[model samples]
Target: MSEDGVSAGGGKMRRRDLLTLIGTVAGSAVMYRAMSAMALAGESGFTGPIKLEGDPKGASVLILGAGMAGMCAAYELRKAGYKVQILEYNDRPGGRNWSLYGGDTYTELGGFTQKVEFDKGLYLNPGPWRLPYHHQAILHYCKVLNVALEPFVQVNYAAYVHSTKAFGGKPKRYREVHADFNGYVAELLAKSTQQGRLDQAVTREDQEILLEAMREWGALDKNYEYRKGLLASERRGYVSDPGGGTTSAPIPSDPMAMSDLLKSGLWGSISAGHIYEFQNTIFQPKGGMGMIGKAFGRELEGVIAYDSKVIDIHQDAKGVTATYVNAKTGGPPRKAQADYCICTIPASILGQIPMNVGDAMQSAIQALYYDASIKVGLQFKRRFWEQDESIYGGISFTDQPNGMIGYPATDYFSDGKGVLLGAYTFGPAAFEYAAMSPQERVAKTVEYGANVHPQYRDEFENGVAVAWHRVPWTLGCAAHWTEALRAEHYDNLVAMDGRIMLAGEHASRLPAWQEGALLSSLDAIRRLHQRVMTS
Candidate 1:
């Protein structure tokens, strides 16, 4: 070959390599840019001074809070063609359902296991076994996504959390210790049932049947008022000894009595036959819960405003207009316009937003709750416990502070090389945990595990914390139905006022879960579509 020909070939190769590098760099830039934009938008805390342009042609819509619910609402509305733009105050969507990506791994920090991934521990004793609402939506979405799931007909799983301690010095004398747990459970249920309406939530016909069984078994020397009081004592966080210790104060009768009665009643009726027919038949997806969230976000990406924050929203007679700042724009916030607005921001934060709306909207926003939670996900250097695919356990804290331990992710292919454990917590204690540094939080988590699984303390020390309360957009974890909070308000939580709409996990038909978030968004969209079409 001639020297000139060799040089010519080298030049062509150089050009080709340069083009390839450029393409790769550009692609990475886009992803990084998108992530940064969303993060900044959330930080701007734009419930501040903002402006908007004229409402776009047609009935354009603006939605806020891009968690699962907001994402679902956008997905539905976009298809219906209302020029929708979802404003996610958070850097990313999925609300509480978030995953961390490090190296070649992913872990779920919030949300429950996917319906398809039923056996990954954390498995719901499905059916009547605490369905947690979102599981139903998960099942539904799985079908839509063409994901597969299986049911566990019979699985031996025993690990749970409760607010009670073991009996101490005094209770040891009573012959009560002889009763097996099943017997105790049976006796308690029978006693409560015989007392009448232990579960106020049940109907008259069912109550009679429950009472008859309780009457047949016969109960201990009874104290209708006393037992009810003990239940209330613990219900208020004054956990008592499981060995039959009593509380000092008399328990209030109304809610606590009903609550305790129902629990005893539930356990009494629960059986393997009942489980097969009622609960514990969990379903799992082929992949993890992350797959489901990724699928939903992937499908709805086009409609989501990844880097925009709705700084302020204003609505007049015709429709509502939203003002958003571009996190990507950097210096000054960029601007975007929308018609119908479906905001998924928690009502707690919404109260702080200075958006232009009526007193009702403002009042509802002010009433929202952002329960404190500490979500810790640990990746051990290795799996240190006898982990069965079916059984998951949670540790209970009787007084000061408590923790829930869960096996959130299993290294199916990696042979347990790395495992993900999760827990849910709320109240002032959660706030304190959230205040710790990443390293400090990890240390605390190790202490938490070391208390229960002494063998795995070092393994746990190798873990990390994904403190949601610290995250700007979320600023908290999990929602609860407090005594002061009304269940029905959840339905009207996002009631529409003029042209504005609301949606989020708290505003769902289900208890606060990923399913509720997704379902709430869809619900908002349905209402929005009607408002626009009929308006």
Candidate 2:
């Protein structure tokens, strides 16, 4: 806290510098915990239900943008005896918590309307699809709303890791890349230890144990060698799968050469599942992610004013008032006022709207930037991935600009049509695809996806592409924050200014996540309630 960035313990380290040191010495998992402790990041600080103990004494609240943050605020504030009303631009609830089903229509920024032609019961979640187990607030709401949940497969060995520069452009199974890479790494280490190369670092007894551990962990042969044999085949899979008949003898597939594997760069995709967020036990709603939004909308039956877009936000000595017009039938502007306001609009759109806040807040709003992203949902004629490739419900990574292909996690072994997340691109790739027409985007996904799954050429049915930057509601995917940006303006953006406060992912350390929005709303409501009680 000193001018020279010195800690009280005689250390010369600023907050950001200290965090960087921790991240360098320790891994991301440890640094994330340290960051969470220092309030630099969050790991879903949801410890059971929020306790809004005191009443608001009939104070009214006007909420803007019925996304996760706004809806969460209205639901909780109303329950705590505060009169709550919400103004949502879209007809439905769940801003980014949306799903596109058959007959669902979306009109992007440039007046391009896409009518989804998916089969009945098929859906594509254009926004969030998977919920990490740690996001307890959203999970709690799901449980409260009686929304059924299902498991989401994060890693499937039957899935693929593809690179155009690798293996003559042939896609490799995830298991092959994973097994071969781990096997080769363990073999090298084991040989080094056996030759006493690690004597300076590892003791004799420790080296022996390490060798044993590596042999087991990497499925190495007794000689600690990774080659075309039963050990490697067991890990990577057989050339011909073990069967039940007279021709049941499985053929061991040859392991890729270590140099070839390294050159392929497919090993990079294998470690993605080991990341903290993408780890096991992820879940999704039984129907779609939008089910949560639909549930929220139904619960707040009469409270939300749908299709009402706020044109301007103004606060006075008494309360906050929002000027608005009907989104669909903009005849004339209307006004909605309340004792306090919690605005959950995305910064991308909010910056363009008229809002009278302090210069700090205004500057923060304009300073924040939203990242570009795009997702293409393609409906295929049959369950070819499951039937032909034995890939059930996981993602197949590709080095192509389209990013990855995600198979549907639900309805296994079904005879009906299925949808595939053919392309999920970000950054420059997203902008490139966004430049194209929706149909062109869909076609590009099919073209790129065919390299991984050739069935796309024959089984393609219909498709819909959602470019986040073009989407009218959000304009971009989520808030993109750098360390410097967060330091300068994050507090100004989140702090309650007079009778108005901002609540969304942009207001929390956990940006681009629904949990951040919910947490921001909870924090805002708690502070607002305290202010009301004290006043």
Candidate 3:
């Protein structure tokens, strides 16, 4: 046997093999612990392309909502020989996957209308902007639909993190706060180890290795202390950068004390990007997130009946039928029929619609509540954030009503006009913003954004604000499911109910994401296709 307890000829066992051995010998909990220690967790459940094997045999399906979920269902079902038709409430294809650009006009539920005045190429994605790298289903569709994508900078070291109650109400660079916090934590741990406080937890040999690793990782001095020095400057950056000329000297910036950093609460912003969904390598469609929906709409031309708002849904043993009305004109109701139905409507609106389903399905539909969110997009005559603050792209978080200010991810270094997501708020702030008029919301967003970007008043040209609760079609943002609700009603909501099935972000574990909608649609149709083949 090898020294590490493997066969002599096996060499060093691979990580997967070691994990398998641990799982086999010990329990899954032990294997999980091993994996966590190695930082080899978080695998995507999406397996490649979904295959609907066997002929669908002319089964007709009626899909509601032309969003990602509905469009995905229509595309795949049609390819699998199922006759498909989609009913959409809006005059366009994308539901919440929407963008606003020059000349675009929107009227909220309170009858407040705003016409976007952005430059020709500048636009704002009002919903679902950033796409995680692990969302394979949506990425697959992006590839299929030929949607170009670019990196979305979720975290930039140069960006600012501000708190009104700390640092004299001033903002600090992300790198300084992040590096200092890490360095102080490492220094404390190293001191504890050296004092023999961690003797029981760490071996004498391992303690040496840990101290060495911590010194390097924490950018500490030889004596295992983090203080004012060149080593610390490398991570948090120097106050005066080194230059290659006659006056070429570098001055190290002092590291913040542990008490000051902890009191500032800037560490909270550092972990925003560390969250699984917001990690690096996140992407956005080249033009806007709406590109995906627009591409799907073009591919499924004439298949989607735009502005056909579904009023009621009825299903029997043989087939399903839907009653609809023109969303714009409010004319007499019309009816559409199919062998099966995949309803992708948000539960906030779907609960009010009359649907003939079991008591369990009805209860599940009513049990879900949608979240409220508000986004404000502001257009500027000049790219003041880039030119003045050197903030090209990324978010600046604050403890204000606006919550966060997101710089434009596109059109970097351009001399022309630019747009920025001025405000993005959720929870109570969202509701407060929703209660205001659209104009009031825009004015308030500009007022709050001025705190972060002082150029807001002078550079501001025009703006648009979307209070999700005021949206006519969705009524609110994505569904918010509690742990108890998921345990009691989630399966019943997604399960095929007689001749009908439900598909959307509301039906999947990943809510409010296009990936969740696509995945839910794929799973729903996969089961529906199986039923079709058997019947």
Alpha-carbon lDDT, every model: 0.49, 0.89, 0.87
Question: Whole-model lDDT for model 3 versus the true structure?
Answer: 0.87
Off by over 4 Å in 3: 1-45
Tens digit of lDDT per residue, candidate 2, span 304-411? Answer: 999998899999999999999999999799999999999999998999999889999999999987998899999999999999999999999999988999999999
TM-score of every model? 0.61, 0.91, 0.91
What lDDT does candidate 3 reach at residue 311? Answer: 89
Stretches of candidate 2 off by over 4 Å are 1-43
- Across 256-280, the per-residue lDDT of candidate 3 in tens digits comes to 8789899888889888998878976
- TM-score pick, better of 1 and 2: 2
lDDT, residue 249, model 2: 90
In model 2, the clashing pairs are: none
TM-score of 2: 0.91
Give the C-alpha miss distance for residue 23 in model 3, angstroms.
24
The per-prediction CA RMSD against the true structure, in angstroms, equals: 24.4, 9.2, 6.2
User: What RMSD value applies to candidate 2?
Assistant: 9.2
User: How much is 59 displaced in model 3, in angstroms?
Assistant: 1.2
